[model samples]
Target chain A: MIKVRKLVKRFGLKTVLRGMDFSVESGEFVALIGPNGAGKTTFLRILASLARPSMGLVSVAGYQLPRQAADVRRRLGVVSHQPLLYVDLTAAENMTFYGRMYNLPNLNDRIDEVIELVGLTNRRNDLVRTYSRGMQQRLAIGRAVLHNPDVILFDEPYTGLDQDASAMLDEVLRTVAARGRTVVMTSHDLARTEDLATRFDVLSRGKIAASATHKDFGSGNLLSFYKGVLEEGRQN
Target chain B: MKKIIEDRSPLSLRERAEGEGKTPSGNYLRAIGAVAWKDLAAELRSKELLSAMLVFALLVIFIFNFALELDVKTRDSVTSGVLWVTFVFAGTLGLNRSMAIEKDRGCLDGLLLAPVDRSAIYFGKAISNLAFMLIVEIIVLPVYSLLYNTNLFQPGLLLIILLGSIGYTAVGTLLSAMSVQTRTRDVMLPILLFPIILPVVIAAIRASGAYLQNMPFDQILPWLNLLIVYDVIFIAVAFMVFDYVVEE
Candidate 1:
């Protein structure tokens, strides 16, 4: 349900994403793995309609990027490393506000359900500032899926989470993907991604260097495959 | 000619079926209100933005009181100018702080992700920034009156303050959105904002001065018109360019 071709992103003299192509089918959970500055976030932002590509043909759910961005945005849910939450407002308040923005129906019920899903029902009335990093991240997930969009882009959702938080997030991610939604998540944690994603796409030097299905690992695992791809990228 | 892309609603299919049945324009207005309400609620709770603006505004008036040891006549003549100056500086603080809150934790991105017109985000922020400026103005007028021993209660002057603030925050909101993406956003706002906001500042000062000095209605009319005109033009411009301004 997502397609990109010859995508190029540049900032003045620096070229970040060079003519790259990537695609994902419906209901596929894609884990985009790369090292720092490999443009994983940049690519996802372009798809999320948060950033425009310098040059590209990007479409999500049959809607074009940049041109049909608004329509694409309608089907898109995005969660970045930053919580994108108001610290001064309660979790419930944040959800309510975003719900109103989305013009969601029966928002109170949805907020309760999503808050419960994120396991923040008890703390829903508490200020986000009082919440821990993990709680904030969880609420961020709830905020992202509040609209129940067809596509969700998560960029390093596990960045600062503890082991327990990461584990909890894995469960949440599983639930989100289980709903038959298409998901694209970028991460450095290969093991976690290996467990969650149906496919792994290795992004290196602003291009998708290699891709494989979870089953393709066979006896080997994601780490070795990732390392192998990077080593190949370095050789080329 | 540029291609016109249709804006779409972000409501889920199921929710859209059971939803408010509001028209697109209705959704737009609600989104604007929702954004403005979000800002107001957060500020009301934290008082982080409002308190900082109030302290800075009060401090500016106090500093002016100590710095300008003018006789009653001179103080009256400069009252409008001083008030505009105070509003300008304090309004800058509010604008910067408002956008900073969004930028701090990627809340701006969150706002942008909404399926409404991007201008809704602009209008919403502009409205909230305007409210904060008006609130600060309401408090500052009394404090200025008590400190300088003059009445700032004139209807014409209050109108001028409102119009001036509408224009200030209109342009300031747009600039702050642009500046917030920069590294030195704190310094960037005023630098970008002050020069662009000159027409509003000058017009406000002149009209307010006319009101405070009890100038004839005819004498106040041109400055008054200028303030109104400036407000309309910039707000329109902000509406048109905000999508591009906040776009990366």
Candidate 2:
């Protein structure tokens, strides 16, 4: 489980994650939804141990970070706005490289599996530079899961993807959740995330103003619920 | 290429490993080796970075040939000095391109996402940068020898190459990482890198020059010692500062 208590992060005078608290049990799929500049990325960066929290106790996978981040990074897989694949290498070579980075056994076989899983098997031999944005996005997904990380973080992975690509991504997320891996994704598209995430945490003004499970979300009305949350924040 | 934005995910390693029964630290070296191997293999196929560096080194040498117009009698003493100048400039080209490839293709993010020590990434990149510099030096050596009609094969000169390249890339890797993120990107690499790496390059060239002149061990020893010290200091600084460069 990942536990974050009293988390606070600041940039100069601007506070990003302000006295935030959150936790995720194993296999939970939590979508962190917020507007731009809402500190969603800051919260996630802190959780990923990429940035240090100004004040907080974050215990992830039994590693105390930023103290034991090396340990934490090994089990954590993250896909941010960047596709993060080497353009000079083919998709196969890229995945193979990442697989080796994680020291996964049967690296070649594992690379093949991720390539197929992301449906990039045909393009596997092509240099990633030749890939369309959608193709590169798929390969990015493949790279993230090459090691079968227990915690998967996706920061707006759906941006720039077309409908077909979005559907493919939806399937990928479902497949990952089906494997019981913990997922924390931040997205602006609440409706698209509705069927994918098990829970939604609304980040507003540097804190989680509200949170809900899919069960409590009610009647498949994600837009209304999301709008309501935003309106509630505005009123106060 | 778009810059890599920070992604934060809340997941703990122990929980991930509890199911897989693998320790995170156990895989660190494998991660570094994998990154290094990937770069080496890619370079072997394309030969782009190495070739560019080699050509650039030769161009600088030829430029030096006309620019200096030194008598053949004085060539031996200046051989190491001239070669290092070529190497440092060529080294920056390789480093910039090396890092620019990662930024453009989004490979740096992929590497960062992998469950490996960030230091592994630093070392992997430094080693690859060093390798490219070495390969260029190796190819350039014979050509340099042929052109200058000077014996460039002294074992001491080879050692100098090793140490100089290490010091060069130690700081080169870190600075390149930062430069690649800026709007100016590839162009900014040398601008930022050269100032910081000045000490290393100076010490390297001095030591390399002394070694080539067949100076007594005592005369060459101080510069050699300086090279070693600079290499160690930069390596540590690079390792510590890499996190900041890569941070989203």
lDDT of 1 by residue, B1-248 (tens): 00011113364443472365788888889999999999999999999899999999999999989998999889879998889988899899899999999988889999999888999999999999999999999999999999999999888888989999999999999999999999999999999999999988998898888888878999999988998999999999999999999887
The candidate 1 chain A region of ten consecutive residues with least summed lDDT is A213-222
Every candidate's lDDT = 0.88, 0.81
Flag regions of model 1 displaced more than 4 Å: B1-20
Reference-based TM-score, model 2: 0.87
Worst ten in a row by lDDT for model 2 chain B: B1-10
Whole-structure CA lDDT of model 2: 0.81
What's the TM-score of chain A alone for every prediction? 0.97, 0.96
Highest DockQ against the true fold, candidate? 1
The positional error of residue B197 in candidate 2, measured at the CA in angstroms, is 3.6
Candidate 2 local Cα displacement, residue A43, angstroms: 2.0
Angstrom error at residue A198, model 1: 1.0
DockQ of candidate model 2: 0.33
Cα lDDT over the full model 1? 0.88
